[model samples]
Target: MTGKINSENGYVKVEIHKVFKVLLSILLCFPVIGMIVLILIDTKEFSPILIVVMLLQVLMIRYIFIGLAFKFLSKDSLNRLRDVLDIEWIKNQA
Candidate 1:
């Protein structure tokens, strides 16, 4: 099936999007894997600040992961507008 941004009679974008989604999921999963590994294997004492910082980093990655997953899953129209829709024209209309 062609996606919202597909070329007529060509499935390139859809194929690319499927591949992109898979790759993105994998990319997003790696951080969780690393965090789990650190929690499981790291015996080196980390300060409270360090633990908090690491947790924040994981949260940051997870947030991006969720946003990207939503964008990929949505049929284009459902996307939450972000940088791409931050039009200067609209912003400066005042």
Candidate 2:
């Protein structure tokens, strides 16, 4: 993904490329697709608990990617992202 950044009057504006947005949306759909396939393949044995667990696993995978991304960022950039997202737990990690 590519981003254009602009700052004015202490506010930061980030513009994400449309292609990047499309790619990201596709990437995010993989887990959902997998879940659908799983359900389709085993309709007779489908369980709500299994679906919930799969969803939790997908969320964990997403956060793992987010953590990895933060690791590659500079301290200032990480701080900026954490602040923008308003996620308090990230502050402790930083």
What TM-score, over all chains together, does every model reach? 0.37, 0.48
Clashes of each: 0, 0
Question: Model 1, stretches more than 4 Å misplaced?
Answer: 1-16, 44-94
lDDT of 1: 0.52
Show pairs that collide, candidate 1. none
State the weakest 10-residue window (summed lDDT) of model 2: 1-10
**Model 1 deviation from native, Cα RMSD in Å:** 10.4
TM-score of 1: 0.37
Model 2 deviation from the true structure expressed as Cα RMSD, one decimal place: 8.6
Provide the overall lDDT of each model, using Cα atoms, as 2-decimal numbers.
0.52, 0.62
Cα deviation of 28, candidate 1, in Å: 0.8
- Assess candidate 2 and give its lDDT: 0.62
Worst ten-residue run, lDDT, model 1?
5-14
Q: Per-residue alpha-carbon lDDT of model 1 for 22-69, expressed as tens digits?
A: 876676667557666776787585345655666676677667755676
